[model samples]
Target chain A: MAQKQINGTTIDVNDEGYMTNHSQWNKVIAATIAEEEGITLTPAHWRVLDFIDHDFQEKGVVPGMRRMNKVGGIPTKDLYELFPNGPIKKAAKISGYPKPASCV
Target chain B: MTGSQPISKVSIVVSRGSLEGIYPGLIMANGARMEGIEANLFFTFFGLYGVLKNYNDKIRVATVGNPAMRVPSAKGLPMPTLLGAIPGMSAIATWMMNKEMEKIDIPPIPEFLEMIHDAGAGIYACKATVDMFHLTKDDFIPQMDKVLTVGEFYEQSAGGQIIFT
Candidate 1:
């Protein structure tokens, strides 16, 4: 575990810089993390993150990319376009969720 | 941490059409794309069964002559090769494997290929095999990028790990 400064607040993070404590997350922190991944937050980006929130709150685990596309109402291509390389990992990090355990 | 830069690219060659053979290569290529690694799939010989339009659904596990064939319902107990030669045993094995995978929500071969393609992985069919099998471009899933020669595969695979299965 590591502590990272995002939006001037110290937060718990993992070795990969993914936030470990969801309670410490906020929109500003998300935007800051997304910035480090070379992306700026957009409504489209929030849509994906919102999907993640709803799913995580209900399931207690981050949804896989397939479920994100099939159930989250976002196509895989659009997801890749929004988050670019390693969309699932990047989006999960920005959404203040742990790194996904999915291999898909 | 291994004193080498994290892998940035990968090229996978799959030459097996059986369920046991093709899935590992597909999984690795998909995993590469999921990690932001540049990735592509090169299908030659029987591996083309995975990419070809006519054969994907026909891909089955080989029960005969497979040393590791087992009775899945019996906790990995090995099955005799002679029993493996029973008619329809191959289909049974494939069905069981698919059932097991679906428990984890893994998609079928064709849909998995589409997912990999959507992840920005290049899916290629081998030109020599296509010619030998007399397969036209129309005979493959629309997701296939191109029919590549061995030279082109090597060219695309350059600067990264080349995994052959």
Candidate 2:
């Protein structure tokens, strides 16, 4: 467990930088985290984040990449372009969710 | 490639062509990509079926002698080896496997490979196998990166974990 200071507020994050407490997430924190990852928040990025947040709320589990592409309406190519390091895992971390259990 | 350097890559060798054998490599390679680790899948021997443009779509589970094969609905009962030897049993087993995978949103072979490729995983075919089977470059899926010798694969996999499936 580690703590990260986002937008002047201290929050707990897992080793991979995913926010441990969903309640602690806010737009400002999202933006800050994105900046740390060398990305500037865009409407497209927000679309993914919003979808992740909504899906997690409804399903109580992080959606798989296939679901993200088929259901979230984001294609795999765009997902890679948006989050270059690791699309699904990075998106989950950026969206303040736990690392997907199915991901290696 | 210092020993102290953190492991950032993996090379998965897929040697079996059966649906059951191939999926493990695909799943593991996909999982590695999702973890932000560089993944390379080397399809050799029968495993080359997974990357072949034509055969990938038609691969079947080898039910005979597969002790792990279980009836999908019968949780405690194992599929009898003799039953597996009967005609059409392979098809039935394959259909059941597909149905099970579908329930969990696992894509079919072609689609799964495409997804992994799109996710930045490298897909390769073994040169020796390709030559022995009379397969040309065009015989592979468009995502196939290259056909390499085992030595070449080892060179590329230097300092990374090697997973055999």
Q: What is the alpha-carbon interface RMSD for each candidate?
A: 0.9, 2.0
Q: Give the per-residue lDDT of model 2 (tens digit) for B1-165.
A: 477876589999999999988999999998887767899999999999999998899889998888877776647479889988999989887888898887788889999999999888889999999999999999999999999999999998997899999
Best by TM-score: 1
User: Can you give the TM-score per candidate against the true fold?
Assistant: 0.94, 0.90
TM-score of chain B of 2: 0.92
Per-model chain A TM: 0.96, 0.92
> Candidate 1: how close is chain B to the reference, as a TM-score?
0.95
Candidate 1 clashes between residue pairs 3 or more apart in a chain or in different chains = none
* Candidate 2: segments with Cα more than 4 A from true spot: A1-4, A10-16, B1-6, B72-74
Q: Candidate 2, what DockQ?
A: 0.63
Which runs in model 1 stand beyond 4 Å of their true positions? none
**CA error at residue B28 for candidate 2, angstroms:** 1.0
